[model samples]
Target chain A: EPEVTQTPSHQVTQMGQEVILRCVPISNHLYFYWYRQILGQKVEFLVSFYNNEISEKSEIFDDQFSVERPDGSNFTLKIRSTKLEDSAMYFCASSGGKPQHFGDGTRLSIL
Target chain B: TQLLEQSPQFLSIQEGENLTVYCNSSSVFSSLQWYRQEPGEGPVLLVTVVTGGEVKKLKRLTFQFGDARKDSSLHITAAQPGDTGLYLCAGIGRAGDNTDKLIFGTGTRLQVFP
Candidate 1:
């Protein structure tokens, strides 16, 4: 079965530096989403994208965060300035209608 | 804000035991989904329930959606070591909103020992 794929399985970045997490959702999927899980915390929704525009975002997805579908296949989340609290497991998901599929996730660590 | 709460945050059972995990919410959802995640990985979808009072079965696992659409339950019969994982329940946002965004439950960690 086709699955969502994320790059840079793990990343370490300095505080105040920028980091971009990349994902390649299933080819035929239309809806894409970003979510984060702090260590031992519940998964939290960050943002959702469809038709090349942000459909919705949470408070955690503030000014520092931005998402782009630079190409037909790539969906990227860029954080302008990383902070210690920004360290978490970021997951990318895609869905055709229901039952969204998730990638393995990218673990972001800020130093 | 919508919130999903799961009961029995952690469970440990011997092989061949039966277990159940529950997800509850005060707010109604258009749909609910169950997922399982192992260490060092993202969640994998197990099942999706769209209608109230719907029941879906996948081999030894069974899922049921509440009649009010505000809760769901997952039951595993004769669980094996492979059934050990973190189970999460998520509620899909209401229609006309960001329906794709999933409001996830606190999670239930299951450890089945063989």
Candidate 2:
């Protein structure tokens, strides 16, 4: 079956450094989302994108975070000046509607 | 904010045993989805329940939505070792602005031993 794919399975960065996570959603999907899971914690929704713009975002998605559909297929999340609390597993998801499909996820670790 | 709470945060059982996991919320949802995640992987959708009091079956697994759409349950019959994973339930709710977002549950980790 077709699936969403994310790049950089794992990443480690300094607390003040910038990082960008990339994802390629399923070809036919129109809605894209970014979610994060802290170790041993529940998954948290960050943002949702549709029609080349942000449809909605959570409080966790602050000024430090941004998302972009840079191309027809590529969706990316960028964190400016990462903080220790930013460490988590970031998952990308896509959906035509109802059921959303997820990617394997990228583990982001900030030192 | 809408929140989903899952019971029995962790469970361990022998192969061929049956188990159930629950997801509950005080707020109503338009739909609910169940997902399973293995170590180092993102959640994989297992089922979606849209209507109140709806029941869906997938082989040895069964899912039921509450009559009020505020809760759901997943039951596994004769579960196998392969059923071991973290199960998560997410509810779709409309925010104040009328946009829908998924609110995830606390999660239930299941371990089936062979």
Candidate 3:
């Protein structure tokens, strides 16, 4: 079965540094999303993209965050000036319909 | 903000036992999907229930959506150690002008012992 895939299973970055997490959504999927889960917390939605542009975003998706489908097979989330609180497992997902498929996730650790 | 609450965040059970986990919310969903995640892996799709009062079965697992569309349950029968993992419930928000948004439940972590 086709699945979403992400790069950089783990990343450690210093405060004020920039980071980009990349994902390859399932082929033929049109809707894409980014969500993060702090240790022992609920998954929080960051942003959703469709038609090569963002469709919606949550409050957690602030000024520092941006998403781009830079190419046919790659979607990326960039965080500028990482903060300690930015540490979490970031998951990339795509949906053809009701159910969404997810990537293994990139665990971001900010020091 | 939509909130989905899952009960019994952690569960431990013996092999061959049966167990159930629940996801509830105040908001109604147009569709709900269940997923299972293993350590170091992403959630794998299990089932999707679109209509209220719907029941779907996969192997030894069963899924049910509440009549009101505000809740759902997953039951694992004759559970084995292989069934141990985190189970998540994600519901799609009521569609508006073709936008498909989702809210995920808190998640239930189940450990099946042998």
Candidate 4:
């Protein structure tokens, strides 16, 4: 079975620096999403993209956060200026329809 | 903001014991999904319940969606050590579309002893 793949399973960056998390969703899936889970906190939705544009986003998805498909297969989440609170497990998911499939995730640690 | 609250934030039991986890929300959802996550990993979809009052069983695991679409539950009969993990319930705000984001529950971490 096909699965969503994420790169750089662990990322450590200095505060105030930029960080980009990459994901390659299932080939045939059309809907893409980004979510983050702070340690000991509930998973929070960041943004959702479809048809090459954002369909919905959560308040946590501020101006400093942006997502792009970049190419047909690669989806990226870029944080302009990393903050200590931004450290968490960032997950990527894709869905062709109802149920979404998630990748292992990228662990971002802002130092 | 919508929140899915899961009861019993943590559960520890011996193998072969039965357990049930509950997910509740004041807001209605088009669909509810259950996922299990091991530490350091993303959630893995276990089941998705779409219809209100729907019941789906996966072997020893049984899932039910409330009639009002505001709640759901997962019952595991004779759970094993392999079932030990973080269980999360997520809900979609709207119906008939996959573009909606998932509102995740607080999560229930279960530990099954052999």
| Docking quality class, candidate 2 | high
The number of the candidate with the highest TM-score is: 2
Q: Please provide TM-scores, in order, for all candidate models, with all chains considered together.
A: 0.96, 0.96, 0.95, 0.96
Model 1 residue pairs with clashes: none
| Candidate 2: segments with Cα more than 4 A from true spot | B94-97
**Fraction of true inter-chain Cα contacts (below 8 Å) kept per model?**
0.86, 0.97, 0.69, 0.90
- Please report how far candidate 1 places residue B41 from its true position, in Å: 1.6
Please, what are the lDDT tens digits per residue for candidate 4 over residues A1-111?
999999899999999999999999999999999999998899999999999999999899999999999989999999999999999999999999767899999999999
Give one digit per residue, the lDDT tens place, for model 2 in A9-102: 9999999999999999999999999999999899999999999999999999999999999879999999999999999999999999867889
Docking tier of model 3: it is medium
CA displacement after TM-score superposition, residue A48 of candidate 4 (Å): 0.5
| lDDT score for residue A101 of model 3 | 81
Of the candidates shown, which would achieve the greatest DockQ relative to the real structure? 2
Best model per lDDT: 1
- Sorted on DockQ, highest at the top, how do the candidates line up? 2, 1, 4, 3
Clashes in each model (backbone N, CA, C under 3 Å)?
A: 0, 0, 0, 0
lDDT, candidates in the order shown: 0.94, 0.93, 0.89, 0.93
Write the residue-wise lDDT of candidate 4 on B1-114 in tens digits: 437899889999999999999999987888899999998778999999989999999999999999999999999999999999999999986545554789899999999999
lDDT of 4 at B48: 93
- What tens-digit string does per-residue lDDT give for candidate 3 at A28-85? 9999999998988877778999899999998999999999988778999999889999
What lDDT does candidate 1 reach at residue A101?
A: 91
Give residue A1's error in model 3 in angstroms: 2.3
